[model samples]
Target: MKATTMKTLTVSLTPHQAAMMQGAVESGGYASNSEIVRDALRLWEQREEIRQMELARLKRAYDEGMASGEGREVSADTLLKELKAEARSSG
Candidate 1:
């Protein structure tokens, strides 16, 4: 992927967060705090992408149910009995 534009900005962190990033760099696990931050941003981006996908799935399911025409009325007990019978047959 083409490199995105970079910006330099100062950020404040709690002592523990600052120490964790510093320790990573000192241990040679990361080149610098900026590298650690960038890696973290990538993970945040992926998590957001997955979150959006789940929301889309839910929306689609809702639309499908809405478009399924009139619903039939069934008692909870009757529905549960049928569901149990279906599960047993499938199993």
Candidate 2:
């Protein structure tokens, strides 16, 4: 595997946060503070990507519903019954 290019960053940590990083290094859990920061950023990036995908899905659903034209009001119980009937038939 090829290594990605790295850039240096200056970060400020609270006393507790600084201690946590130092403890991890002392315990051999991480090679350095940079590794821990990189891991955190990777996780944050993944979460942001998932959030964006979900937002897109919600937007599509909203657009589809709006384009579907005027809607009729149905009772909650009636809707539930219809949904259950559909599920049973499909299964």
Highest-scoring model, TM-score: 1
How many clashing pairs does model 1 include?
0
* C-alpha RMSD of candidate 2: 2.3
Estimate, for each residue in 6-85, the C-alpha lDDT of model 2 and write its tens digit: 99979999999999999999999999999999999999999999999999999999999999999999999999999999
Clash list (residue pairs), candidate 1 = none
lDDT score, candidate 1, position 58 = 100
Error of 2 at 65 (Å): 1.5
lDDT tens string, model 1, 11-73? 999999999999999999999999999999999999999999999999999999999999999
RMSD of each: 2.2, 2.3
- If scored against the real structure, what TM-score would every candidate get? 0.82, 0.79
Model 2: pairs clashing at backbone N, Cα or C within 3 Å = none
Model 2: number of clashes? 0
| lDDT per model vs. reference | 0.97, 0.98
